[model samples]
Target: MADPWSKKNPFLSMMLSGANAWAGIARGIMSGQAKGQQAAAARQGNKQVADFWTSALTGGTPKRPRTSKKRR
Candidate 1:
């Protein structure tokens, strides 16, 4: 009592398989892009914080660290 029209044919099966593969690839690409953006934002934030602290400690402008003079 199986319906002949409901049966899976080769072309239909191939198309469905291709669609699934495309979906999986898209998901992977989207997740990787999100992760890369997150990492970049974190790096930018860290740099800003470091700059702020450096300027604050150095009295507005950053300066080179003082080196100790050796005895002659």
Candidate 2:
């Protein structure tokens, strides 16, 4: 006969193992996807910021400037 206090609870045992496994699987998938998304967003944001700076520094329609003479 099984001891009264040490008796196994079938419901908790069944749910615990599968739930723990599922939690690990979900965490891995979510974290992997989250990391990929974060990397993509960072690259896109950096490219956009770099493009803005490049245009700000170098992009303009070229034009001729007037000459000035110094009078001493």
Candidate 3:
């Protein structure tokens, strides 16, 4: 049987790539490197996720974000 953890396994490779991406994002956030636009973008993404779950569970509309201004 083929090894499930081998790099040739597409599913494992995809999962590893996602993990690497999350690690980079976490590192940036922890190191204070995700600044200004990056930080705002991250916050917005997180809010969207939270809103999605909240609305889904409560059967309510997702809350609007606090800011709509475009980041340069």
Candidate 4:
């Protein structure tokens, strides 16, 4: 039996292929953003934990960071 729905039409086949490529690109972009967000959240959580430990070690007094003053 001959397949009537074969990809004989070049235009339709190209359109379908283009759509599939676009969908894959979109999925990759979304996954990348999600990974970035997860990384950011993990960094923030680690900072919070470090701050808590610093405070605990310093008897609840968080030390202020020293800044350089410009001489006039």
Top TM-score prediction, candidate number: 4
lDDT for each candidate structure: 0.95, 0.92, 0.86, 0.94
Q: Model 4 lDDT vs. the true structure?
A: 0.94
At residue 71, give the lDDT of candidate 1: 75
Sorting all predicted structures by lDDT, with the top scorer first, yields 1, 4, 2, 3
**In terms of lDDT, which candidate is stronger, 2 or 4?**
4
Question: Candidates' TM-scores?
Answer: 0.67, 0.64, 0.36, 0.71
- What total of clashing residue pairs does each candidate reach? 0, 0, 0, 0
Q: Model 3, 1-72: lDDT tens per residue?
A: 867665387787899999999999999887785467788999999999999899889999758879978899
Q: What is the per-residue lDDT of model 1 for residues 1-72, given as tens digits with 9 covering 90 to 100?
A: 999998879998999999999999999999999999999999999999999999888878747898799779
Candidate 3 Cα RMSD after full superposition onto the native fold (Å): 18.3
A best-first ranking of the candidates according to their TM-score comes to 4, 1, 2, 3
**Tens-digit lDDT string for candidate 2 (1-72):** 868879898998989999999999999999999999999999999999998898789875467897698778
TM-score of candidate 3 on Cα atoms, chains taken together: 0.36
Off by over 4 Å in 1: 3-6, 62-72
Query: Which has the higher TM-score value, candidate number 2 or candidate number 4?
Result: 4
